[model samples]
Target: MFDPVSTPDVQALVYASFAQLRHCRYLLLRIQDPAAARRWLRQDAVMGLLKARGQLGRETAQDEALAVAFTHTGLLRLGLQEDADFPFPSAFREGMNQPDRARALADANVETWRWGDLPGEQRQDVHLLLAHFRRTPFDEQGPLSAPALQAGGLELVQSVPTCPAFIERNEDTKESRLFEPFGFRDGLTQPVLHSTAERSRRLQQRREIDREMADDSVVADGEFVLGLPNEYGDLSYAPDDARWPSAGASANAPPHFGSHGSYLVVRHIRQHVDRFEAFDAAHPPPREGAPSLTEQMVGRRKDGAPLVQQPMPPADLDGFRFRVNDAEGFQCPLGSHIRRANPRDTLGSDVRSGVANAKLHRLIRRGRVYAGECQQADHGACGHADGRRGCGKGLFFIALNADLDRQFEFVQQRWIAHPQFADLDNESDPLLGGRGEAAFSVQSPTAGTRTTGLPAFTELVGGGYFFLPGLAALRFLAETEPAPGPPAQ
Candidate 1:
C-alpha cells in the first residue's frame, strides 16, 4: 500500500514544524576533489537531519532543520553525466535562464544572475548547497550540522561561505507572528497538498487547520514533488531511466529512480527599505489623510491582516477566500499585490476561469528576510546606514516545484511582471510587479478608487536553479566509480 503518512526520505525536506524554524543558515561549497566528496556524501552524511513531508510525531521533535541541494553544474562535478535512465528536465539541463527571453519573468540579466556579483565568500566556485534552520527566533548559528559537517570531511573542499536568513519577531504585538524588513507578516498563506487519494480523503475528514493537509484546500503534490499525481490526476513528468537504450539500470530494485526528488529555485533578492519608505511618503494617494495608504497598496495590513473583507482580522488570519466579499474589486483593489499575486476568485473575465487559473500556478514558498541594520519599526523616514548600493536587506526567496516553468515561473511572468492584467491598463503588482514604474490602485469606502505612483522596492541580486535529489539518487551518485582510460572513439 502507498503510505502517504510515512515520510519518503530525509532528502525530501518538506517537514512540518510546531515552533516554526525561525533562523536559517546557508553554506555554499565547491568540490575540487571528487573521490573524497563522494565518499563523504555516501558514508558520513546523515540526511535524517531534515524530516520528510508525511513524518509522524517524533520526526520534528528535535528543534533544528537541515537540507542539502545542488545545482545542475554540481552533478557534473561529481562525474554524474547525462544518462538515459535519468534525463534531467530541460529547464535545468539547458543551464541558467536568461531573463530577456520570452518566458523569463525575473528582473535580472545574465550578468546580474551570476554568483560573482555576491560580495565576500558568496562569489566563490559554488557547486553544492547546504541550508539549516532553528526553532527559536532568538537564535545563532550553532554547530555545523549533518550534510555540512559531512562536506567538511571531504579532503578537496575549495570554498565554504555562510549566509544567514531569519525572521524578526513582531515585538510590538503579543502574538508570535514574524515580520520581514518591510513589516509584512509572511508565511501566512501557503498551499496545502497531498500525495495519495487516501491521504486526500483523510485530510478532508480532518478539516482541522492543525493537520498535515486540508480538504479542497489540498493542492496536487505533483505541483511540487516529482513522481506524484498532479492536479490533473496524471503523473508528473520526471527524470527516469526508461526502457530505451539508456546509460544505466532497468530493474527497479534497491535504488529507486526519481521517486521523491524535486527541483529547487533560490534567488537572493534585495529590498530597498529606505527607498520604499521614501516613495510611499512622497505619494500618499490622491486624497489626503487616507487610512492605510501604504497598507492598501500592499493589500494587507503590516500585521498580515487583509484590508478588504475582514478589516478587523481574526487572530488566525488566512482561511477566507476572495470571491465571496470582494469580487467586484470594491474591497481590495485589483492592482494590489495580493490580488495580483493570487487572484483566487478575482481573476480575469469570470470567477470560474479565475479559480482554474489560480490552481495552475501555485507555489511552495520558503522565503526569509535578510536585513542589514533597521530590523524593527521605521523611524518615520528613510533610515539605512550600511548602504550596499542603498539596498540594505531583502528576502532570500526559495521554492520547490516539479515543473519550473508551469508553477514558479508562470506566477512571475503572467501575473507579477505583466503590466496589463484583468483589463487594467499598464498596472503592475504594487509590491513585486514592476521594473521601475509600479502604479497601485486601492479601493476605499470614502475617497473612491485611489491610486499610488511608486518605484521598484525589490531587486534581484543573484540566484541559481538547483535540484534536490532523492536519497537514492544521492547514494547512486556517491557510489559510482569514475570511468577509467581514454576515449572510446
Candidate 2:
C-alpha cells in the first residue's frame, strides 16, 4: 500500500531494530586492511545491502530481512582523518557521548562495571560493526564468525551473537517466548520515526498489527537520521565550540556533516542473573503486595504487565502516563526503575509537563537480551547456528539518536546514575546502581510510601559510541583513503 514513488522509501531512515527484528549479531571487526576492506565493502558486500534497508511490513519482506550498520571507528578505518574531513557528529570527535565508557572508567565503578569498567573502550580500535538481523535459520559456530566475514580483508576481532535470556517452548502449540535476563518481555516499547512519509506509513502498518500501542507524537526523522529536524527545529548540534565545524555555504556552516547519519550507542551489560535470583528469593515481600517488592522495582510483573494495583482499561504502549494516574507515585513509585528511566511528569514535582519534558530526552531503544540460550531458545536465526556459549547472558543495548550528549549520555549519567532522582533524597535508580538509597518506593494515596532496598544488579561490561552513516555517506566512506596508522614505531 506504500508507493515509493511519492513517499520516500525510509530505507535510509531505519536499519537495525527499526523493524521487529529478534536476532542481531554485533560483528566488531578490526580493519586488518583498511583499503581492501573498503573495496570489499563497496564492490562485493554492499551490493544488495542498500536495497535491503527498507522498512519492514507485516508479511516480512525478504529485501530488508537483514539490516547492516557501520560504526564511527569503522569509518576511521576506511581512511577518514581530521574532524573536518570526517562526517561524524561532534560528540564522537571528543569521545564524550558514550556515558557508559566515561562512567565505567571511574575507580568507584570498577567493581560494578567489571570488564567494561577499564579504559579499553576509551579508544576501541573496533573499526567496523555489522548488525545482521537474520531471517533464515543457520548452524554457524558464531554469528560474526561465518564465512561471509572472512571474505573481506578485515579480521574477526570479536563475534557476538544476539542471545535471549531464557526459552519457553510449548510442544502442543509449537510456540515459544524469549525473555530478558531479568524476567520481563524485552523490546516491548520502542519509538516510532514519524518525520518522513515513508516512516509514517510503515509505523501505521505497525500500529494496525500491534494494537498495544498508541501515540501521534511526530518525532522528527532528523532525531534519528542525519539532516532532519530535531526537537527544537534545529540540527540539535551542540554549541559552536563543541560542534563539529562545518564548511559549506558559510565559512563556518553548522556542521551538517552528520546530516544523514545517526549516533549509535552499544553497551554490553552483564546482568548478574544468579545474584538477582538470590536477592529476589531473599527479599520476598508480603503476598498482598500488587507486584511485590521486586516487581515494583522493575515497574512491571514478570508477565510484562505494568505494576498497576488495579486494572482499568486496555491500552497501547504509550497509553499509560505517570502524571495522570500515578502523579504522586501512588500506582508506580516516583523513583522506580521505569519511572527513573522515564520520569514522565513526576519529575521535579511537575505533573502537567511530564510527557512534554520527557519527549526531548527520548532515544530510540533497540536492545536485545544476549545470552547463550537464544540458539535453541526456539530455532536458528537467519541460518546462523544458535546455542553457542558466547557472551554471558546480558543486554545488547543499542540506542539511536541525533544528539548523543543530550540524549544517550544524558540518560545514562543523569537519570540512571543520578543519586537524587525526583524529590527523593539520595536515591538513584533502584534497578540500576543506587549507591545512596536502594529502597524501591511505591507511593500510595493511603500508605504514603512503601520502600524496599535493592542492590545494583547490572554491570557495564563494554560499550561504545559510533555514527551510523547514511547509505550514500557509507559509499563515500568506502571510496575514502586508507586510515593513517601511528608513526613507524
Candidate 3:
C-alpha cells in the first residue's frame, strides 16, 4: 500500500499514471447554450480539484483537473469537445444521410478511407474530420484546475464506458493470466514511480544535451515538456505544420506558440487473439529447443526477453532486466511487439541524441486488457480450455507530444509499421501491421525463425480524434458560438 503522506511525489506520479490509464470514459455534450454548459461544468457534483498552471496549458489543465476530479469522485474521467461546423463534402454528407439499408455500404467506404485505403484526397478528408473533433492540447505547465466545470449548462448526449480494473488472484488458475493484445505477459514491465527519487533516477538515465542533439543543439527543459526543436529551431508540431496549426495561427500567433499544449492521439484497436492463436498453432516451426509458434510470433518468452537472445529459463521473471538490445535477435527479437513499439536501447547512434531525434515520443499508456469468452463461438476454437475466450483485445493506443508527425506518427508509421527494420526480415509490425486485407510477416535470423502470412487480425471499430484544448482555448471555445450567417457578405 502506498502512503502519500510519506511520499507525496511518488503518490503524485502514481496518481498521474492512473490518470494516464486510458480507461477513463468519454462523453459527447451538445449544449443548447454555452453559458449553461459552463454552468454545468462548474457544478460541485462534477467539479474536482484545480490543477496548477504551467502544467500543460490551460486547456490540458482543465482536462487534467477533470480527470483527477472524476477519478476522485469514483466517476470515470471524460473528455468533452465541440463539433466542427464545416461543409461536409456532398458525397460525405450524402452518405451520412443514407437509408438504413445503404448506411452500411456508405460506412464501409468511410471505414476503408479511415483505415487509409482510399485515395489521398478521400483519406485526407476523413482524417480531417476525425482530427477536427478529436485532437487535444498538452500544455504541461498549465494548472490542472476546474473553475470552469462549476458554471454548468452542458447536457450529456453520449458516453463510452470505462473498463473495469482487474483483480489479481493468488491461484494458478488460467484466469490469472495478464497478457497484452499480442499474447504475452504485460502490465508488468511498466516503469514504477513510487517516489521523487525514482522519477529523478529515471531522469538521470536520460542522455546528455550534447548526446541528444543532432549537432550542437542545446536541450532545454521546455523541450522535455514540449518536444525537441526541429532543424529550424522551432518546436516540432504535428500532422504537418501546413495542416494543423496552433488554433488561430493563421490570423495571429500566440505569445507562447511553441509553449502550447501537445497533441494526443488515442485509438481503440480490437485484436483478434483467437485468430492469432490459431495461426500460430497451425504454423508450427521445425527446430530443436526452438520457440513455440506463439513465442516466435511475439518475439519474447513468457518472461519478456527476446526468445532468441535468452533461452527461457525457469527463474526468468517478468520486469527483470529486459533490455531491448540484448542481441540482434538473441535476447529479444528485433521485431517483438514491445520492441517495435519502443526500441529503447536498440536505437544505435541515434540513441546518443537527447529526446529530440531519440524518438523519445513517450506518452503514458493507460489501457486495460478486455478479455472474456469469445463473442463469436462459431468463428473460432478456444486457445486454452480455461474457457477464457480472449477477444476484444487491443491497445487504447495513446500518443502525447508537442508535435504529432514528429512524435506519434513517426513512431507509428516509421518504427512500428515500417516494413524495413534493421537486422530483421519483416514486412510491417507483426501485431499491428498489414495494409488493408494483406497479410504481414517478420523473420528473425538469430532464432532461424520466420513468422509468415499473419493475417490482419484487428479492426478500428470506432474512434475519433479529440483536441484537448488549453484552458484559454476551452474558454475561447465556450465563448465563441458559431456565427449565424456568412458575415457582411
In candidate 2, stretches whose alpha carbon ends up further than 4 angstroms from where it belongs are 1-21, 50-59, 63-71, 81-90, 96-101, 104-125, 139-151, 164-178, 196-218, 236-257, 308-312, 347-352, 373-392, 434-437, 445-453, 482-489
RMSD to truth, every model:
6.6, 6.4, 11.8
Evaluate residue 288 in candidate 3 and report its C-alpha lDDT on the 0 to 100 scale.
67
| lDDT tens digits by residue: candidate 2, 1-489 | 212222222334253342333445666766667667777677643545443234333324442333345454555556655344433455565453245446532214333332221134333445666776554333463323456456667777566676532334354673445467766655544555554354555456546543322342346556666555666676544222122334653453324444456777777777887788788787676656456666777777777677643224534334466665666776667777777776655543464455556667777776666655433543334113433223347887778877776777677667777766666777767766744566655666777654555656876656666666555445656765544466211
Ranking of all predicted structures according to lDDT, beginning with the best and ending with the worst: 1, 2, 3
- Candidate 1, clashing residue pairs? 85-240, 85-241
In candidate 3, residue 116 scores what lDDT?
A: 21
Q: Model 1: runs farther than 4 Å from truth?
A: 5-7, 10-12, 17-19, 45-50, 54-56, 99-103, 113-125, 135-176, 195-216, 241-256, 281-291, 310-316, 348-353, 371-392, 443-453, 482-489
For candidate 3, write residues 61-140 as lDDT tens digits: 23333432111001101222212332212222233213341232212333343322112233321111111011132221
Q: Give the Cα lDDT of each candidate.
A: 0.58, 0.55, 0.38
Q: Which residue segments of model 3 deviate by more than 4 Å?
A: 1-15, 19-24, 28-35, 49-65, 68-158, 165-183, 187-197, 201-260, 283-291, 303-327, 348-356, 369-393, 423-426, 436-447, 470-489
Superposed Cα deviation of residue 366, candidate 1 (Å): 0.9
Q: How many residue pairs clash in each candidate at the backbone level?
A: 2, 21, 67
